[model samples]
Target: MSATTPLEPAASWYAASANAAPERPPLSGEVSCDVCVVGAGFTGISAALHLAEQGLKVMVLEAACVGYGASGRNGGQIVNSYSRDMDVIEARFGARTAQALGDMAFEGNRIIRDRIADYAIDCDLRDGNLFAACNARQLKGLKEHQALWERYGNTSLELLEGDAYQREVSAEGYTGALVDHSGGHLHPLNLVLGEAAAFESLGGVIFEHSPLVSLEHGSPVVLRTAAGAIRAERVVMAGNAYLHGVLPELEGKSMPCGTQIIATEPLADDVARGLLPNGMAVEDCNYLLDYYRLTRDNRLLFGGGVNYGGEDPADIEALIRPKLLKVFPQLASVRIDYAWSGTFLMTLNRLPQFGVLNDNVYYAQGYSGHGVTCSHLAGRLISEVMRGREGRFDAFANLPHLPFPGGRLLRVPLSAVGAWYYQTRDRLGL
Candidate 1:
């Protein structure tokens, strides 16, 4: 693959209105730390923050500015679940283990709230998330899922039926939904930036524009870049989709997928409320899901549609605008002010990948589309494992993540072929 810099976020309304982040200089001189972290997104930054909080000397290197990846470009919906269903997880791992994983998924949400309160990070935090069912099939599954939530002792979830659902959401496409009061939305970029600053204030070192070009796993790992290098007792590879070829061993275990999002110009407060009367973040129940939420400023931040292929389409706004209009035709007249794409990693099983290379080098990624909360939990788990507390890490590492069947050259193509089939099935309502 040709070497690429961080692509500028498309004319996203978030970028135009996002709060400015503090500047940090790139690494110029070689540095040694207890741990060297690659990728400055939420995962890397959160790990650095946790490690620094423990008085561990940590350094973070980024390919671009902080929050430049999916950490900043995501839909900003702070959902409280994993990308894959519980049954899928239970089928692969036993019921006990699967239930444990489900609990951790919700733990990620609490981590976000605790961090925000601890650091006083102001990112327009909101409450409530709704998983809207578009048809009877979806509604049935959602109702069953809601009951399961109650059985699990999770009382925050409420099942909204037909009339209530229609009143809560302006769209007619959904029959009903499962509302989660604990789940919410936030300004992702601001949260990422604020977390990075907090980590630095605790004596953590972060190097911007310092992409790790190579890594050598050994007794003490070495991470090399264009200008400087890091030699540490332990190395954490947190660079998700953008982590191409940095480690050959990790190549086939995960594939980089692209997801896009668009933000519309701000609407009047009343209009925004009319669009989402409950002010809850909404996501449709489908393989290729459409998720949207109203920003505190009254703009609709719509994220739907994904690409299995690596390349970003030229007409991003054109590609996503129709989906937004489909959800709320009232917004058809509102102009889309911002749009952008970011790479997200997905494993074959849609479970997060966590493991060590020869007991010294550790890596975690492939959160699929549920990284907003999972990434933070990963940092805590990884940090704990680094401290020799491996129970939580083992829960995720125990699950199997096979490499893509076709290897490097044929992997993307083969996956794309299968994905195209699933997408077709989705379109035909199969």
Candidate 2:
């Protein structure tokens, strides 16, 4: 591919408001490095930055521009914990195993803040995120959710019921909300763009528009692109949903799912303040949930709905508008400034996948819908393995990853059926 790859996120709100960036030159000839990181999204960039700061010659190969994938187009909420809650991990994986994971669950959020401040990145960051419940059942679940995280040592959690919740969010139909004071939200694309810049400042090189066409994961792993190749002592696969054919083993192990988001025009100051009084990002408690927050400019940015098999819906606005209105009916007359969709990897168990491949190649993926923070955690863990440490990385790497029961052809349909059932229960408050 050429150095001028067409970025798919051109239509996203983040793209329009992202910080100024320079077009990086793609590799056109053979190059070698101590570490070759594939995909310059959060995982790849984080890993490359960590290794480079350690005095390693790290080179990152990105198929598109940095943050082109889920890193750029996610809901942007810095929600801690994985897609599966800590209680779920405790129930199935045991308290000892869950305790290990729970200890690190909030570490990724810290990494993000450290990157922003240490790198002098100007991404608009706000603290606190809310888990809102639409019904009594979900509300009760939130109460238990708070207790579970508290047991895991998350001291920043507080549950608000009825009138207490109104001080934070004036949205309708919510019985209560669980607030995570430590959790937050930010301009995701700008965050990645700033982090990518930090990586480069540490003497790291990132080749934009350079896709890893093939991989020979041996002693000195060889990564081939259309115009050049890389020979490295080790390789890191951070592509996630965008890896495509590069890692065939992940075919049935995970699936890419598309999510829709829309940004509304700036609202009046009073209305903006009235909508989300405390400026905390909110996500409903449902199998398929609606997440929304006010952008720095006071525009309500709402996102919801997942299309299995990574299919973009025919109308992004049509699919998300109704959900947005349900939360804030006062925005009925607001104009949608931007609407877009992006894909993220979803594993069968909704937990991230981290392990070695081909001996010299390490991969961390399948963040499900929670890649914003977990991806950074994966990067740090992968870097530890390269620095003569494996204790923390082994915690996640040792967990079993189950492939979708059906073959690739049937996985999507089967997963869709499962989602439908759960969403149905969500609708009925079961």
Candidate 3:
């Protein structure tokens, strides 16, 4: 009944597929740095990489292994816009602010692609993404989205209809689709490992298995762990859902959202090409979207089936097989080889939250499912702000986010009940 319950480390295809990552020893002694980052996911690793590149003494503390958080285990869809739709942003924050946010989301996509190329990260980079329309309403929405994208001079979004959708992805479930060149997919765990390696390569210190259990804020903030501690001029809370009491003010702003995925054993290369010859990531346009892509080995890595109650259903394959079969019924016989889940934070507004509570206390979270791209962008912005350039950080900091309703005790249940309603709606086509 509690969504905050820890998710078991389900066997993930990424874990089995990625190359071995270099191991950093756990923290054992006290250390000092200009900045200390409190998570080992994309944001923390990225910030460490950027900060170290700028010649700053940075230390990153990881509660678990690098990429052990949602960054290592996600749908791997590099979306082209914010987690919340543009209309929602414009309705809440006016047209100008919404447009700027949209532009930033676009840039977030670019950041991932550029980073992969610059770092020579081999993460099975794909070049296009498809937003499939499961119903007529969604088809019309995709058209409207295409028009708006063109109005903003985003010509990368192409409206696919009729035979084109069937031809490109070899699927008949969607009424139509929107293809965005700006967005794509990659091997998420590999990307995270490569980023961590890049950060260390640039001389940043990373301490694995060093969870910060206590904090003392001042001119030089102190972060204490079981075996080690860090005293630094700046402290960044980037733990997302895995963080607890590292900072009190950050507690109620977001709820941990649990999502699951399954991957089939490799299909014949010709079979995969028959299914999706274009080699792009495909996700339906729904409240709880079913996202999937072909792995480099030609396996269908499908992700769907969300559980807000933090209880993974006993029959996860049963719960999600229907969703998969709905999209690609032709592949109903494919054997599912791996299934897993990860918790990512989600705000009520679904926009990312960023700011400094005090001068030396900086934090960013609530990226929802947009963590892959936004986390990288967060690192860039945080690095800029750390170097006395606060323009980009302030842009994201200006966005408004409301705390969840029930504080700690009831927030999970409230989120679960609300998510159930949404999932039900998704099932019933509301």
Candidates, ranked, lDDT = 2, 1, 3
Candidate 1 residues lying further than 4 Å off, grouped into runs, are 1-3, 7-10, 420-430
lDDT of 2 at 7: 52
Q: What local lDDT does model 1 show for residue 94?
A: 81
Give lDDT: candidate 1, residue 294: 91
C-alpha positional error of residue 388 in candidate 1 after TM-score superposition, expressed in Å = 1.2
Steric overlap count per candidate: 3, 0, 0
The RMSD (Cα, Å) of candidate 1 is: 1.9
Model 2 clash count equals 0
- Candidate 3 TM-score over all chains jointly: 0.94
List, residue by residue over 243-312, the lDDT tens digit for candidate 3.
8766667767877778888888899988999888889899988877888889988989887855653455
**Candidate 1 residue-wise lDDT, 73-99, digit = tens:** 888889876887676778878898878
lDDT of 3: 0.82
How does candidate 1 score on lDDT? Answer: 0.83
The C-alpha stretches of model 2 lying farther than 4 A from their native spots are: 1-6
Model 1: ten consecutive residues of lowest lDDT: 1-10
